[model samples]
Target: MLSRGGAVENDRGSFREFVEKQKQKGTLVLLKKPCSLSLELAGVMKALDGKPVYCDKIKEVPGARVAGNVFCTRELICEYFGIRNEELMPKLVHAINNPSKPELVEGKNAPVLEVTEQEVDLSKFPIPFHAPKDGGPYFASAVGIANDKEYGRNCSFHRMMVIGKDRVAVRILPRHLEEFIKRAEGELEVAFVVGAPINVLLAAAISVEIGKDELQIANSLAPLRTVRLESGIEVPADAEYVFEGRITSEMVDEGPFVDLTETYDIVRKQRVMKITKVHHRKNPIFHVLLPGALEHKLLMGMPREPTIFNEVGKVAECKGVNITPGGCSWLHAVVAVRKKKDDDGKNAIEAAFRGHKSLKHVVVVDEDIDIYDPESVEWAIATRVQADKRLVIKHNEKGSSLDPSADPNTYATTKMGVDATKPLVAHGKNFEKAEWKAIKKEEYV
Candidate 1:
């Protein structure tokens, strides 16, 4: 475990600082060989999908580096926050419930403003063409930050494809960013932040009420500082790169890219954004998040855990929630609860779906079962579940579009909920597993 002072030093939300710390811990793989931005960079990253990797040499951009899989697992994220696995739920819930505003600093104080680009050419950076089927070189990790008169400030992730020297097509869903664009009459000044801290990235993916600033939640998670761009858009002061732009009314094709399900998403006409200015720290490290990979899944799914915990707590004592990776971390979840009544598991299943609307299947188990372990969850199902009595199925429900089996047009599919909690009163068989005392086998040998 890291000391309190160490956590404080790294809690300011600096991506470069986090990378250096990982390197010092001997967990980061340093690749000194020159690599291409086309496919080689992403290919290497995919090959080492669950490990942190840093590429120091880039063929396209001199003095630029790329880092991937920095936060690919829950253990890495927990370590970054200086917390244990069990504490993550409460920490996120507290941060969301009590948000604090970040300290605003001038451009001179912000390290990201140390260098300003004379011309806006995105190709000069290390943006990777992840796969052959991708429409274009994509920026899968950039967080789009925009301000709204009615909703204050909003931050969300948008996959961007480089279309020209100074333009990119962004896939904007019907979320806060779209609302902000609509309020501004189809054009809004925005900032795309690359290489943000883990706290900021996690907070941006959280689905909170409108008018609630995600940056504030990030600040509550850790000490964070913000700097305003020339367009008056605020971004993390310690970010590696900040692209100031305007999401224009123009629409263009965007997709054939891999999504959360590791499947190709259909092409759609999305909004185009024109970059007006670019700011970065000296020798900035670009963050490349491979689509449908571990890092992507964790970022998209972990934030939803707190929401599920909150909803499940209303009816049962929610112990833990795991958005299992096998479900692509979006469509399936395993929830552990301390059952107080016969229907607690079933109630938790219903509430879990309510917490994450895109969830297609859910399993509710007792506290004894480890929600994070696939085999443990299956064991609970095998021992405690009876399909006729414990299964809850909803037909023709709105599900995730990432599920290829669902109707692509409506995202409609059948949802299943399995109550795999053991009965409070066992009829004949013992629900608890047998235990024994520990001994040192070396003495006997």
Candidate 2:
């Protein structure tokens, strides 16, 4: 286990503190060259997809800084939470199960409210034009927080495209935010927070009940403080930037942006948001999440791991779950379980699908197999799996929108589950791998 002591322990829920820790550890890359918001900054971000990057010289926005790939990998996320890889699922599950309210601070003491501009101009910030096919400069890292009369409050990620000085076309899915908008009669007040802490970011991406507040889950993960905006929308007090906005009845075409699968999403008429105010801390750092990149995939997929683990646990003694990045971290997953019966693997497969509706493929392995290692999982599949008996397939199933091969209109695809667990009783062939005792190489040499 990694050490849980030091600066990280002291500043567990502070985004700036985490960045500074990464800098001290030499894991964060600093870009001294001036970069442009139009493709160049995103290009650099993509080029270094799995490493934390910071750039202070923005050609478009003077005195502004941008950071990317901060939590791009599972290891980085674990480091942020001061946990090991094996502990992630339990931590997430605990947070989801036991959510606690965050402390509310006044606007006067909130760091985010240090600078507030009533006359909003989004173009003045360092929003990125990620790819050539993108509709416009996007705030891909923004987590929108909105409240409803019935649902109370909802926090979720909404990709927004800058359309004017104070307006943005936001892609609103038929989820909690949409429900909140409808409840508010097609106009809902929202606060889009950028450069939030890892706990808040992970909690926002989680799919919970509509009325359940994600900020509470974030607080459970780590102590969180929030400040209520003038619009009555509460946001993280330590966030880099907060855009006080309203999702209006007006709509505009908003897409051609890269999705989780690195494919261009089709244009659709989306809701328009009018930013009434903008607030940021001194020397604010913008979070630049390049569309369809590792950071994007992890944020979208990691939260689903706990759900899959929970469902699989109902059927079998679940050991671990890995949403592989090779599957775009959305469509494919590997589950490890302590197989008690011959049918436990199959039962786990069914439960895993029930856990995450968007999962297209899953492989069930014995507890001995390391689900995190692709080679180990492949070895298990090759050795233990007999396609004729262990393969389970479902045709024309509802799948993820990120998968390009799925039906464009319906998003339906074929799903497969492989029971790769070894039989309890080996009849003719040995299923276990032969291992030698541990040896000291240095002594032998």
Candidate 3:
């Protein structure tokens, strides 16, 4: 996390004060007075156990409210991108629509003072243990940078789990970075980061189309942010925690705990890494992610939003999606769409499956319905849908790895979809859209 900032009169970048200063305006919910993250970490443990309370000292840092709950809500995500939550999609579509080249700055030193190429230590910093069953402390969240084998461009956000003080497991999908790692002869360059421009982490989460470098989409999200290759690592000038390492073919047991899907997964062999260098600002904040939390769902599933929106748009006036927590945030998705035809709901079901190949089940609702409201969606299915007509595919489709009922080794299971939308042309022919009686203004008052 060697951040390099330039002064008005100098081409040489100056090392910024600390991680708290690099944050957007005021996101540092820090207690200037000394308090151990160890104490706060214990509090987080209890909070997840249904008892949450933060140190009263933290209440002093301007907008420094409690940071225990999800630090990655939709509102928080939008604020990070400098956009309204409602504008997230169009902004995403816009960025994907108009990609730009990232500005690169090269210098010996940056706000990221020294690289710390040698004499690296994992201790001496604040790293939280987000979950009880985690292998060990996780240093960074929402980041892991790897250069592509097809092209030397960097692809980031493949999570890294701490195995020990000097080791980590680089989690990668078989066909993904695994392919890149293989192409590179099983020797891969990796950098674990705590924070970046925020936009870069979003794009790198899911590189939907090939060759559309996330760095390109990142530059489109915020101004004054530049992308550069430094000391063989791709990074933002103000990144919080950065560690340089190498992912090798050496395998180790990766997990036996809950995932973003919020369900426990069987431990399996995953690639291991040896840390070579550790870089960060003074008194750096080490972020930890709970196995299954709001932040986890957003990081693991939200990136799939644009793909779903794009696919569903072809079939219906699709608005957005919310992966219900009850369904482990991965097995099921509730899509919101405006029915253009009688079968528009069914069309949306097909699109959702295409967007996320692992989706086990999908429920499509009308625009007037609230997808986030369980009762609202149930009402639509109960009143507008006929089980026989609305229910779409129910056959052997790919099953989610998170579904405990499904055999992860074989991935054998069925996928189901329900089309819950009001019939456009019912017993009446050429009917106009339904309208309700207008209510008196301020009637409740």
Candidate 4:
């Protein structure tokens, strides 16, 4: 959904191109389902299905496509941002801290009101049943365009549940739309736009402490982006659909299903709103995100990575960071650094915790080791890490409420960090890689 100059791709590719690329890569699997909505189908799909395969077109949302595994893998995320996997974090951080504000353009065909549906019905949209315990159909792909309290314009992503024909339960967080909601004191005006551009969706999904109005960040990410809309709702003009709505104080049961971290979460008693209207194009295409899939983690985790990088940069030459898979996209953090001082690791540890607040385990390693490599990081810790000198463990630290293990509604649990960089020593066998030879790909492949 390009909003300004031309039809710039929201991501590296278009919705059609995405399918083509997946086809070329021989990655996407085709399946035939009759708009399956059974609770068991969703569970089976998650438990048994492979990576980002297309569900083809569902009967309910005709001409619409649903793809999962969007961010479950690094290659997919790299594809989305048009960068190498190694460059994903830095690119995201750069884009987040220095986002370009959206430019308004005159357009009567603005998606928010274009073919606006007056007789709204949530059931008409292909809302998926992610889990058996899930309360209702969820629009996992929708982008919640939140109105900033201080600035009156900002947008973020929060899971919304279709509680009614004209309403949904919005899940906004402190660093995201929830912050704006509080600024408006319980009742916040918002625009819930679904069937989004992939890049715009990603920009909203993988963002950090960025100011209100991330459409600009998304636009800058896709330099050729052309956004044009005059209805006060700042969004890509080419996006398939955009609906203006509000988050109300009305509360309802939210969830008791599995989350992105691959954990069964019990999100009970949440605020739900009544949907007033919906807008979409004729035979508009609908998109759904795989709840708790790679794309979900990437979109959710990558943005937070920048937050950690910014905070840790103050203390060390933090090069890059990644939230490991074992951490379920929220629990663990792996930070790559060019350690300048002996205490750089500790500073990074504190900065990481401070940056994310919910991080439990942090590992700081030299740039030589791949933070994404479990074995490599383990080797660094085994050889260079010293518990007495490098390990920093603090009790009763803040943690994630999404973490069922953590004591919720209270203080954070114990968190720890290991400086996996080799100790700077002259001759004490302090830190050195054991003898190993690099092998050529031809020898193995």
- List, residue by residue over 66-140, the lDDT tens digit for candidate 2: 889999998888887778878888999999999999989999979999998988878789999989989999999
Ten residues in sequence with the least summed lDDT for candidate 1: 1-10
Stretches of candidate 1 off by over 4 Å are 1-5, 8-11
Worst 10 residues of 2 by lDDT: 1-10
lDDT of 4 at 210: 42
Off by over 4 Å in 2: 1-5, 8-12, 443-445
Question: Candidate 4 local accuracy as lDDT?
Answer: 0.68
The alpha-carbon deviation from the true structure for residue 443 of candidate 1, after best TM-score superposition, in angstroms, is 3.2
**Superposition TM-score, candidate 3 onto the true structure:** 0.81
Tens digits of per-residue lDDT for model 3 on 1-445? 2222221222122112222232333443433443344335534533453211222233223222222322356665554444576787677777776777765655343343334546665554445544566665554364766777466555556556677777877667764566678888998887776655446666676546554567677666553233344446566555556777888889988765557655556778889988877776443434445556665566666666677778888878988786676675667888998777777888899999898777788889877788778898888777777677778766666676677777678777788898877677667542234689988879767
Clashing residue pairs in candidate 1 (N, C-alpha, C atoms within 3 angstroms): none
Q: TM-score of predicted model 1?
A: 0.97
lDDT of 4 by residue, 1-445 (tens): 5332223345323444455567677776665655565453365356544465666456555665555544457776566556777776777777776778554544564433457766777777667877766767777777777656355556667677777777777665667666666677887666666656565776776644445457766766664233333335565555656666667788787765567766676676666665665666555555556677666766677677888888899999988888876687777888988877778888899999888877889999988888888998898888776689888999887777778777867746888998887655547564655677887989888
Residue 157 displacement (Å), model 3: 2.6
Shift of residue 40 alpha carbon in model 3, Å: 6.3
Question: What TM-score fits each model?
Answer: 0.97, 0.97, 0.81, 0.86
The prediction achieving the highest lDDT against the true structure is 1
Model 4: residues with Cα > 4 Å off, grouped in runs: 1-17, 20-26, 33-35, 40-50, 57-64, 103-105, 108-114, 182-185, 206-211, 223-231, 435-445
